[model samples]
Target: MDALHPHGMPKSAAETEARRLIADWAQQPDQQPVRHFPTAYRDTTPLPAYGTTPPVPQPDHRIVPAWAAGIAVASIGVGAGVTGIGCGAWLVLQGLASVTLTSVLLVTAPFAGLAMVTTAVAGAVGRIRAAVTTHVYEGPVTHHTEITNTSHQQGWFTRTRNDIS
Candidate 1:
C-alpha cells in the first residue's frame, strides 16, 4: 500500500491534498471572533456584601430513618399479598356459593374484596409516599448545593479577552 492510497485502492491526489488543507484550516483559531466587553450589560449582578457567602445547606446526620423506606416497602408487599389472597379467597367463595348454595349474598363477595383491596392499596401507597417524602437525610453524609456566577459580558468587537476574565 502506498501513501497516496490505502488497501490497494487509488484516490485523487488533488482531493487528498484539499482534504488535508481543509483539516488544517479547521484546526486554526478564528481570527475575528466575538470579544468580551468590559462595560457590556451583564445578565446577573454580583451578590450583595451581606449575602456574598451563600448559606450552605446542612444535612441532618444525627439519625438515619432508613427503616421508614424498609417498613414502607414491606408494608406495600404485605398489602399486595393480602389483597391478592383476599381477592382470590373471595372469588373462590363466590364460585362455591354460586354452584352449591345459590344465595344472593354471594354477590357481595366482589364488593367486599374490592373494598379490602382498595384499602390495602391506598394504605400501601400512602405509606410509600410518606417513606419517600419523610425519609430524607437517611445517611451520615451531608449534602450541599453550590451556586456559582458564570454569566459573562458580551459585545461586538469588544477589547476584553475571555482569558483575562
Candidate 2:
C-alpha cells in the first residue's frame, strides 16, 4: 500500500489526483506569477562620486629613539623586579601561614612518639641479644712489623732503607 494514500488507491489514480491538484493550485490568482512592467520615465541624473583616489605607496623605515628604547628596557626591568618581590612576599606569607605550631605538633607528635618507642624497644632488644650472644675466634694469629729510616744528604743525595721483623 502507498503511504501517501491510506485508502490504497492505484498508482495511476494517485498520479492523476496529484496532477489535478497542481493544476487547480496554478489556476488560483494568488499562486499565479506577477508580471513586471517597465517604467515609461528614465532617470538622467549622474551619481555623485563620494570616494577619492588612494595615496601613492611609500617604503617605511621605522627607527626607535635611543632614550625611548632605554625607557622601555628600564620599565620592563622594574616590572620584573616588582613581580619577583611580590611573588617572594606571597611565598613567605604562605610559608608562615602554613607552619603554625599547632599544625606542626599535630602532624609530627604521633610520628615522634612512635619513633621514640621504636628506638627504645630496638635498643633494649639489641642489648639483650648482645648480652646473650658470644663470638669466638677460630683462626691462627700472626704479627708483622716494619721499620724504615730515611736520610737526606748534601747536594740532593738521599738514602732510604726498610727493615721487616
Candidate 3:
C-alpha cells in the first residue's frame, strides 16, 4: 500500500484499475477526419460598368480675384516708395540743420593732416627696425617621420611589428 492510497488498496489492484480506465478511454469512438477539395468555386455574377455616373462638381476656393491681388501689390509698392522718399528728405534736412560743409572741413582738416604725417613716420620706423634685426639658424633640422604597425592574430595568440621611416 502506498501513502497516496489511504484506503489500503494493494499496488496490483491500483494498477489493474488504471489499466481498465485506459482501456475504456481507448474504446471510445474517434472524431471524424476533415476532408479538403482540390478545386475552388467563385461567384458568377457580372460587375457594374465604370464611368457611367456623372462627375461631382467642385466648389470655387479662391477668396480674392487675380486683378484685385495685383492692385493690392501695386498700392503697397507705391506706398513704400513714397515712405522712402519722405524719410530721405527728412534725414537730409536734419543733417543740413545740424552741421555745415565749411564748418566740418575747418574742424577736421588739421587732424587729418596730423594723422597722415604720423602714419608716414611710423611706417618709416618700422621698415628701419625690421632691416636692422635678422634671424639665423646653425643646427641640424630633421623632417617628419611616420610609423606603421602590422598585427597578426590566431585563436588565443596575437603578434605585432612596427616599421618607422
Candidate 4:
C-alpha cells in the first residue's frame, strides 16, 4: 500500500518511518518476529518441597599418616609458589604495580626453589616411612615395627592392629 499520503491526518512522521523500517527489516535472513510487551509479570513462585536428605560422608581413619603432612604441605607450597611466580610475571607485564609484583616474584621464586629442594631432600631421606601399632589387648603388647630397604629403590610399608581381647 502507499507508505504515506502527502497530508495524512493521524499517522505521525515517526509511525511512517517505523513502518518503512519494518518493511525493510522483513527482507533480512536472520531477523525474528519482534513483539513489544507493555508490562512484565511481577511475582514470586512457590518453592518446591523436598524430601530425602543427603548422607554425610564418614571420615576415613586410614589417611596419610601425620608424618606425611610435612611432605604434602611442602609439595603443595612449592606448586603454589611456582604458580605465583608465573602469575606475578604476568601481572608485571600487564602494567600492574611493578614494585609489588617484583617483590612477590622475589619472595615466591626463592621459596619455590627452596621448597622444591627440601621436598627432594626429605623424599630421599624417606621421612614419610612411619610405623603405628595400636595395642587393643591390655595384657600383652603385640605391635611390631621394622623398616627394611630390601629393594634397591624406595618404597612404603604400613602395619596396623585392630583387635579387642
Give Cα distance to truth, residue 26, candidate 4, Å: 88
Q: Cα lDDT for residue 159, model 3? A: 97
Q: Model 1: how large is the Cα RMSD against the reference? A: 38.8
Candidate 4, residues 30-70: lDDT per residue as tens digits? Answer: 97778897986644655447875545468988877877998
Clashing pairs in 3: none
TM-score of 2: 0.30
Q: How high is the CA lDDT of each candidate model?
A: 0.73, 0.84, 0.85, 0.72
Number of the top lDDT candidate: 3
Which candidate, 1 or 3, has the higher TM-score? 3
Task: Decide which is better by lDDT, 1 or 2.
Answer: 2
**Candidate 2: which stretches are off by over 4 Å?**
1-50, 101-165
Best-first order by lDDT: 3, 2, 1, 4
How many clashes in each structure?
Answer: 0, 0, 0, 0
For candidate 2, the per-residue lDDT at 41 reads 58
Writing each residue's lDDT as its tens digit, candidate 3 over 28-106 gives 7594446887986665656558755544468989799899999999999999999999999999889878897898899
Checking candidate 2 for backbone clashes, the offending pairs are: none
Clashing pairs in 4: none
Off by over 4 Å in 1: 1-44, 47-65, 101-165
